[model samples]
Target: MRPTLTLIAASTLLLATACTTTPLPPQTIGQCNAEPASWAIGRAPDQNLIDDVLRDTGSRDVRVLEPGMAATMDYRADRVNIDVNDRGAITGIRCG
Candidate 1:
Protein backbone atom coordinates (compact mmCIF):
# COMPACT_ATOMS: atom_id res chain seq x y z
CA MET A 1 0.00 0.00 0.00
CA ARG A 2 2.82 2.44 0.79
CA PRO A 3 4.64 1.73 -2.48
CA THR A 4 1.46 2.13 -4.48
CA LEU A 5 0.73 5.47 -2.81
CA THR A 6 4.28 6.69 -3.50
CA LEU A 7 4.07 5.76 -7.14
CA ILE A 8 0.74 7.52 -7.51
CA ALA A 9 2.05 10.63 -5.84
CA ALA A 10 5.10 10.69 -8.08
CA SER A 11 3.02 10.21 -11.19
CA THR A 12 0.65 12.98 -10.15
CA LEU A 13 3.53 15.38 -9.55
CA LEU A 14 5.10 14.61 -12.91
CA LEU A 15 1.86 15.04 -14.79
CA ALA A 16 1.10 18.33 -13.09
CA THR A 17 4.46 19.79 -13.96
CA ALA A 18 4.36 18.51 -17.51
CA CYS A 19 0.91 19.99 -18.13
CA THR A 20 1.70 23.41 -16.76
CA THR A 21 1.87 26.30 -19.23
CA THR A 22 3.76 29.49 -18.62
CA PRO A 23 1.73 32.59 -19.22
CA LEU A 24 2.80 34.75 -22.17
CA PRO A 25 2.46 38.47 -22.66
CA PRO A 26 -0.63 39.53 -24.52
CA GLN A 27 -0.14 40.09 -28.26
CA THR A 28 -2.52 40.94 -31.02
CA ILE A 29 -2.05 39.92 -34.63
CA GLY A 30 -2.70 43.41 -35.94
CA GLN A 31 -0.10 44.86 -33.65
CA CYS A 32 2.57 42.16 -33.53
CA ASN A 33 2.33 41.53 -37.26
CA ALA A 34 3.18 45.16 -37.95
CA GLU A 35 5.91 45.56 -35.37
CA PRO A 36 9.01 43.99 -36.92
CA ALA A 37 10.13 46.76 -39.26
CA SER A 38 9.74 49.48 -36.69
CA TRP A 39 11.42 47.39 -34.02
CA ALA A 40 14.40 46.13 -36.01
CA ILE A 41 14.98 48.70 -38.72
CA GLY A 42 18.32 50.47 -38.45
CA ARG A 43 19.05 48.26 -35.48
CA ALA A 44 21.28 45.24 -35.12
CA PRO A 45 19.81 41.79 -34.37
CA ASP A 46 21.53 41.41 -31.07
CA GLN A 47 20.52 39.08 -28.27
CA ASN A 48 19.14 41.87 -26.15
CA LEU A 49 16.96 43.19 -28.93
CA ILE A 50 15.76 39.72 -29.77
CA ASP A 51 14.92 39.01 -26.17
CA ASP A 52 13.05 42.28 -25.87
CA VAL A 53 10.91 41.55 -28.89
CA LEU A 54 10.26 38.00 -27.83
CA ARG A 55 9.08 39.20 -24.47
CA ASP A 56 7.02 42.04 -25.86
CA THR A 57 5.32 40.07 -28.56
CA GLY A 58 5.17 36.75 -26.76
CA SER A 59 6.33 35.11 -29.94
CA ARG A 60 7.10 31.43 -29.75
CA ASP A 61 9.80 31.64 -32.41
CA VAL A 62 11.84 34.27 -34.22
CA ARG A 63 13.94 33.99 -37.37
CA VAL A 64 16.36 36.60 -38.66
CA LEU A 65 17.02 36.49 -42.38
CA GLU A 66 19.70 38.34 -44.27
CA PRO A 67 19.51 39.61 -47.79
CA GLY A 68 18.66 36.87 -50.32
CA MET A 69 18.82 34.19 -47.68
CA ALA A 70 16.55 31.22 -48.05
CA ALA A 71 14.37 29.98 -45.21
CA THR A 72 12.17 27.01 -44.57
CA MET A 73 8.85 27.09 -46.38
CA ASP A 74 6.81 25.73 -43.49
CA TYR A 75 4.72 28.40 -41.85
CA ARG A 76 4.10 28.63 -38.14
CA ALA A 77 1.39 30.76 -36.65
CA ASP A 78 3.48 31.65 -33.65
CA ARG A 79 6.57 32.76 -35.52
CA VAL A 80 7.89 36.14 -36.62
CA ASN A 81 10.48 36.65 -39.36
CA ILE A 82 12.75 39.61 -39.56
CA ASP A 83 14.42 40.44 -42.85
CA VAL A 84 17.56 42.54 -42.87
CA ASN A 85 19.40 44.32 -45.60
CA ASP A 86 23.09 44.02 -46.44
CA ARG A 87 23.84 46.70 -43.89
CA GLY A 88 22.12 44.62 -41.20
CA ALA A 89 19.25 47.03 -41.07
CA ILE A 90 15.81 45.51 -40.86
CA THR A 91 13.77 46.00 -44.02
CA GLY A 92 10.71 43.84 -43.53
CA ILE A 93 8.74 42.05 -40.87
CA ARG A 94 6.32 39.24 -41.52
CA CYS A 95 4.37 36.76 -39.49
CA GLY A 96 3.74 33.13 -40.33
Candidate 2:
Protein backbone atom coordinates (compact mmCIF):
# COMPACT_ATOMS: atom_id res chain seq x y z
CA MET A 1 0.00 0.00 0.00
CA ARG A 2 2.83 2.42 0.83
CA PRO A 3 4.54 1.83 -2.56
CA THR A 4 1.25 2.34 -4.45
CA LEU A 5 0.57 5.65 -2.68
CA THR A 6 4.14 6.84 -3.38
CA LEU A 7 3.81 5.93 -7.05
CA ILE A 8 0.48 7.78 -7.34
CA ALA A 9 1.95 10.86 -5.65
CA ALA A 10 4.93 10.82 -7.99
CA SER A 11 2.68 10.47 -11.04
CA THR A 12 0.54 13.42 -9.93
CA LEU A 13 3.62 15.57 -9.40
CA LEU A 14 4.98 14.60 -12.83
CA LEU A 15 1.68 15.43 -14.50
CA ALA A 16 1.51 18.79 -12.75
CA THR A 17 5.03 19.68 -13.83
CA ALA A 18 4.28 18.67 -17.42
CA CYS A 19 1.22 20.93 -17.48
CA THR A 20 3.15 24.17 -16.96
CA THR A 21 1.92 27.10 -19.02
CA THR A 22 4.23 29.01 -21.35
CA PRO A 23 3.90 32.73 -21.96
CA LEU A 24 2.39 33.71 -25.29
CA PRO A 25 4.48 35.62 -27.83
CA PRO A 26 3.77 39.33 -28.20
CA GLN A 27 1.34 40.27 -30.96
CA THR A 28 1.33 43.34 -33.21
CA ILE A 29 -2.01 45.14 -32.92
CA GLY A 30 -3.10 47.34 -35.82
CA GLN A 31 -4.32 50.86 -35.08
CA CYS A 32 -6.45 52.75 -37.57
CA ASN A 33 -6.01 56.49 -38.23
CA ALA A 34 -9.12 58.16 -39.59
CA GLU A 35 -7.58 61.51 -40.46
CA PRO A 36 -6.06 60.39 -43.73
CA ALA A 37 -9.25 58.74 -44.81
CA SER A 38 -11.35 61.80 -44.05
CA TRP A 39 -11.27 62.56 -47.75
CA ALA A 40 -13.76 59.74 -48.23
CA ILE A 41 -16.49 61.53 -46.36
CA GLY A 42 -19.40 62.79 -48.48
CA ARG A 43 -18.23 60.54 -51.31
CA ALA A 44 -20.02 57.48 -52.55
CA PRO A 45 -18.91 54.12 -51.22
CA ASP A 46 -17.76 51.58 -53.80
CA GLN A 47 -15.23 48.78 -53.85
CA ASN A 48 -12.54 51.09 -55.17
CA LEU A 49 -13.29 53.79 -52.60
CA ILE A 50 -13.40 51.24 -49.80
CA ASP A 51 -9.99 49.93 -50.83
CA ASP A 52 -8.62 53.44 -50.89
CA VAL A 53 -10.02 54.18 -47.47
CA LEU A 54 -8.42 51.08 -46.04
CA ARG A 55 -5.09 51.97 -47.55
CA ASP A 56 -5.23 55.58 -46.43
CA THR A 57 -6.36 54.77 -42.90
CA GLY A 58 -3.93 51.86 -42.48
CA SER A 59 -6.84 49.77 -41.33
CA ARG A 60 -7.11 46.04 -41.74
CA ASP A 61 -10.82 46.03 -42.49
CA VAL A 62 -13.71 48.29 -43.50
CA ARG A 63 -17.35 48.30 -42.53
CA VAL A 64 -19.99 50.29 -44.36
CA LEU A 65 -22.92 51.27 -42.16
CA GLU A 66 -26.04 52.46 -43.89
CA PRO A 67 -29.00 54.13 -42.29
CA GLY A 68 -31.09 51.88 -40.03
CA MET A 69 -28.41 49.21 -40.23
CA ALA A 70 -27.62 47.18 -37.14
CA ALA A 71 -24.00 47.17 -36.06
CA THR A 72 -22.15 45.75 -33.12
CA MET A 73 -20.96 48.13 -30.39
CA ASP A 74 -17.55 46.51 -30.21
CA TYR A 75 -14.65 48.83 -31.00
CA ARG A 76 -11.71 47.59 -33.04
CA ALA A 77 -8.67 49.71 -33.66
CA ASP A 78 -7.92 47.99 -36.97
CA ARG A 79 -11.28 48.76 -38.55
CA VAL A 80 -12.69 51.74 -40.45
CA ASN A 81 -16.42 52.32 -40.47
CA ILE A 82 -18.16 54.51 -43.05
CA ASP A 83 -21.66 55.77 -42.43
CA VAL A 84 -23.91 56.46 -45.40
CA ASN A 85 -27.13 58.43 -45.63
CA ASP A 86 -30.46 57.34 -47.13
CA ARG A 87 -29.52 58.63 -50.55
CA GLY A 88 -26.50 56.28 -50.71
CA ALA A 89 -24.08 59.11 -50.11
CA ILE A 90 -21.27 58.76 -47.62
CA THR A 91 -21.95 60.89 -44.56
CA GLY A 92 -19.19 60.15 -42.06
CA ILE A 93 -15.92 58.32 -41.67
CA ARG A 94 -14.55 56.98 -38.41
CA CYS A 95 -12.17 54.58 -36.85
CA GLY A 96 -13.32 52.14 -34.21
What's each prediction's clash count? 0, 1
C-alpha lDDT values of all predictions: 0.74, 0.90
Candidate 1 lDDT over residue span 1-96, tens digit each: 999999999999999999999999876553345364466666888888777665565567888899879899987767777778898877776776
- Give TM per candidate: 0.58, 0.69
Model 2, 1-96: lDDT tens per residue? 999999999999999999999999866355688899888888899999999999988888899999999999999989999999998888888998
**Model 2 misplacement above 4 A:** 1-29
lDDT of 1 at 21: 98
Best by TM-score: 2
For candidate 1, the TM-score is 0.58
Least lDDT summed over 10 consecutive residues: which range in candidate 1? 28-37
Residue pair clashes in candidate 2 = 76-96
